[model samples]
Target: MRNETYMWKILAKTEPEKTLYEHTLDVLTVLKEMMKIFPDVPKLINEPNFWDYVFYALFLHDFGKSAKGFQESLRLGKRWGYRHEIISAGFVACLEYESEIKKLIALGIASHHKEIDELKSKYSTHRKNSPGYERYTKALREIEENFGELVEMMKLIPDLSEEFIGKKLTNFKIPNSLDELLDVFSFAVKSYEDSKSSGIDRVVWLKHVFMRGFVLGCDYLASSGNLEIPLLKNEISEIIRFEKFTDVQLKMQSEDMKNKDIILVAPTGYGKTEASLFWVEKNQNDRRTKRVFYILPYTASINDMFKRFVRYFGEDLVGMKHHRAGYFIYQSFRDREYTPDEAKKFANAFVDLSKKIYKQFKIITHFQLLREIFGLPGFEMGISEMAGGIVILDEVHSYDARVIGLLIEALKILKYEFGARISVMSATFPKFLCEVFKRELEIETFITAEEEVLRKISRHKINLINDSILNGVDRIKKFLEDGKRVLVVCNTVKKAQEIYNVLKEFARGESKLIHSRFALIDRERIEKSLKNESVQILVGTQAIEVSLDIDFDVLFTDVAPIDRLVQRFGRVNRRGRLNYADVFIFTGYLDDDLKIYDKELLDRTISELLKVQRINEVDILNLIESVYADGFTQKQSKIFNETRESFLRLRKEIYPMLSNKIADEDLHRLIGSIEIVPSCYENDYLKMRESGNYFEVVKFFMSLAYPQFFKLHRNGQIYQHSHTLFCLAGYDKELGLLVDEFETNILE
Candidate 1:
């Protein structure tokens, strides 16, 4: 017979040899902390006994690791072919709870590691008289031998109810065959499907959602060594009390703004960041907010805000998520002088922690949150984490029409379904667009900088140049020689590279080029280099519009829509520290420029530019209104409505227990981007991957648009190995991706 404490000897983690009992304790510790932060989690499903279910699920989640085959695999450091969760879930049948409660607990435990379909696919063949029945029976017998010891160990948990501990856990029937064990899984799935179809079972559905989401949250947090969720420090309020608020910011923080949706229209330099924080401070003080998400459009802006927030609020209170968030976190750690090994360790850990539910504040790209509505894997946790939270959407006008439509629908669900408060901010928000948001979000407060304040700020004098911006190299060089920092914006990456190559020839001071194609590691270096006052000439595409915060003496750019052009203009003499900066618009362009921006919009932009010699801050709204007067084109409007309608249907199809594989595929497809390694880094990528240096492997990846990816792939320019794609496309340290086939082919 096995010893009384034999169950405690089962290993949950191998590297450190932590026993099952110890791991359960760690997870329960996290549960206690999370309950303090979110006491209403039980009330979310109208089930007062929800906490008890969570405890039962966590206790039985890993007992199947005691199977002889699983133990040998762990000891030998070999792959375990079968999932332990399947057998662990069989323990639910031994509980004396009601049938419905037992099904909920079983589903939560079984699906914690794998989604519903995946769990079924892996074990469907293991029924009675099946190929794997004998093996399944053997594992069950092993678990039965240790069941008594497991219950003895459970008696140690102080959080477990006294009645539960006193019950005869052995009296409940143990599965004598594979068919009986499979019944538990079958019942759970049947109940889940029934709940999805019945309107009356909506509460049942929500109960399962919190059950699965919180179970996964606590399990992952504990397994990763983060045994507690960090509490939100009252840091935002302290900053608001100490820092002086600008006129626009003061309006955003007014007492009436509490418990209301907000629309804030402010110019670029009007302290929108501070205003949003103050709004958050007011909301935090007024209600019980779970978490706060500050959403941005571009990764550059997200990274900048992540660093700024970490500085203001301690690093422990702030976290970030994006495609290359791991790289940014790794870089931030290295900046603090951590050794490469240490940085890599902490970066990997924090990446897991940030994506989970530990941090109080999350700075993320819109795509990160959009994945939740799309019902991607682990989306239940995403929804649970943001329930009763505050969502701050900055630069609301930056996304395309399709994304704008998605946001409207997602925000509706977040507000009415999940109880999240939203605050939208934009520099160039038009009245028509504001009306759309106001109707959808039910915005209560409309805050804008006073016209007098805008009139007092004069930053740029717009000038129209007859020749192409490419022909203005001489003018740019002269500015560099005169100790003036020059900014050059182009419509296409090819154009930017061409102009940068020309400028580097005769320019006197440091010059740099930025676009969308460089690897994140190299891009960070280029952006950091821009901080030097000596970098005289900076050239880029539309990427420069919102990606950087710097003042230039002059600007030369191709014609674009007036709103985008205004964003570009904001980069020059940004603070009005200089009397006025000159912005020269080039009239000449090739046919390729039309492919980037709409010809109609470009024409309207030129027509508007012809009328104004200087862009005054106060009159900028009128200029934007004139250009976007028609709102989205008919075709763009169709795309928006179609995307919005289809996404709403998709949301309805998603339930708590099952994971939609199509939804995951749709997310990647909609993102329209893929990460790839340039051929130059193939050797380094392989070496790092082999050495288990995943952080180093991540550094070599750069995002490429799907169009470019498909084009290169069809031409035999890309290949995949070990789940990573390697591209033969050429890359330059200063010029970014070399898209010319001639150049890329030469590298091949």
Candidate 2:
């Protein structure tokens, strides 16, 4: 007999040599902390005996690991013949409790390690002659013996006394026969199936997902041995108070936007972010608006917004979710004074917690929300959390037609099905696009900057150059020579790099190149360098179009779409202090122009630019409406219809039938991008991998458009170095990836 007076002996170990009891305690602590931070957890509190049900699930989540077979497997470093979750589920079923509570506990335990499909297949037809029946029976006998020991151990631990586990369990008996054990397991599985299929009992659905997610979150946090809770300080007002509001912002605050979706059309400097935050604040006290998601199109924009929101909401309450979110969290942690080990531990914990719990203000790209819409694994909880929240979609006009259609479908679901409120804002929202939303949404409040306000912000004088983009080099040199900041925007990465190479020689001060091809860390450094006084000339691609707050004295850009050109011009003379900044638009080469933009739209945009002498916020909006007045072309219409149909089908046909396994590749393809690490960073990548600094290593990777990457990869220009790293032979340090050199007919 084991010593009942001594500490409980080990049953299993999450980490090598770590005791199962220690792991259990860690999980319990994490569960408590999560309940404090996660907004959705509070909804469950109103349920009768909810806390008791939660405690029961957490207490017995790992009971099956106490089985002798499992313990032996852990000691010998071998795989157990049967899953411990099944044995754990059987134990929960045997407990004497209300049938509903017992079923919830059993489902939580059973589905913790595997999905419903895997669970069903494991115990189906549990006959003696079945392939896995012998192993299953042997595991059940071992679990029965371990169950007795667990009860004895619980009696010794003060926290697991009869009061917490319930007095009804004092005479609890393990199923005496295998047939009885199978029956209990079958009932638990059927209960879960019924709950999922019923679909009408939202309360039951929420409880089911919350219990499963809570258990898994606790288990993961405990196994990692990082128990620190990253919390946001309650300082929403401190961040918002420092800035003086403009007229647009004041109007936004004075208006009543609670419970209504909004369409805000304002210039870049009109405090759109502030107005959106103000709207959120107005609805903050409402029970429906529990969280806010600030959605942007680009990763850079998301990162920038995350930092800005952190300043307002504090680091603890604001979180970022993107592919490089881990890298940003690591950077935030590194900014503080911590020893190497301490930094690693805190950064890991921060990343883990932010991903698992939805913060009060979450800055994310559309991909994160799309994951929920696609019904991906582990995202059911995310979808549940998003219900009754506010989602702010910035740069609404930037996405292509297919993406626009998909977003429209997603918005329909979010508004009609999930009860989420949406606010769509952009500097150059077209009339046609506005019509789409107005027709789809039930009630939308449209707000635009007054003409007087736009006139006061008018800041740029336009010039058209019929020559090649290189012809603008002389103007760039002249601006730099005169001690004025100059910005050059190109339509393609190769053109931007070429222009940068030539202008760097004539530049009087700092000259930097920025584009999408550079690694995330390098791009971040470039963005920071833009604010340096010594940086006189900045050359970039469309990346300079939005989110970046850099202001310059002059602009030189290649001709493209009208909205894109307006965004580029906004980067110069942004504050309206220069009276009139020079914006020189040069036409790209014929092949290059068609490759980068729609030929008809490019023609119309150029025609409209010729008509305007001075470019202002109102002029930009007019030009956008003129270009899109005819709506999408026949081909574009086909693509949009197909995309919309596909998404609607997924929502109606596939979503309900989906199990835990989501087709991630299909979603990535729909998004038209993929993340890869260039071969040049192999040495640093290996060093980081060996040092276990994965989050930091992600900063050195870049996102590539799928069509470009696929074309290159098929031609043998791209190589897979490992699961996470890919090598592109054409990647250049200064020029970035040469995507245009080899490509198909795909257009962005």
lDDT of each: 0.78, 0.71
Clashing pairs in 2: 231-316, 232-316, 232-317
TM values, all candidates? 0.90, 0.84
Worst 10 contiguous positions by lDDT, candidate 2: 739-748
Q: Which prediction has the highest lDDT against the true structure?
A: 1
Candidate 1: where are CA atoms >4 Å away? 1-11, 66-82, 94-98, 125-127, 132-134, 153-182, 190-205, 240-243, 285-289, 471-483, 663-666, 743-748
> Positional deviation of 176 in candidate 2, in angstroms?
7.9
lDDT of 2 by residue, 1-748 (tens): 2232656665658445665566666676766665544443444434655545656667667777877878888888777777877766766655668777677777777777776567667664345567566556677777654555566554433344233333233434444443455333556666556554554254565566667766766676667665655543343334577457776676567647766788988988778899887776665643322668888998778878888887676776677777777767677667876665676787767666666543567888888888877877766556655656678889986888888888888787677656677888888888888888788875468888888767766788989889878777876788888889889998877788888999999888888899888877777788888878688989998888887888899999889888888889888888878879999988655676676677888888888888988866777788899988988756677888999988875654222212743477678789887777766676678788889878778876888888768776777657655567464545556667666453221121
lDDT of 2 at 357: 47
Task: Tell me the lDDT of model 1 at 639.
Answer: 80
**Cα miss at 224, model 1 (Å)?**
3.0
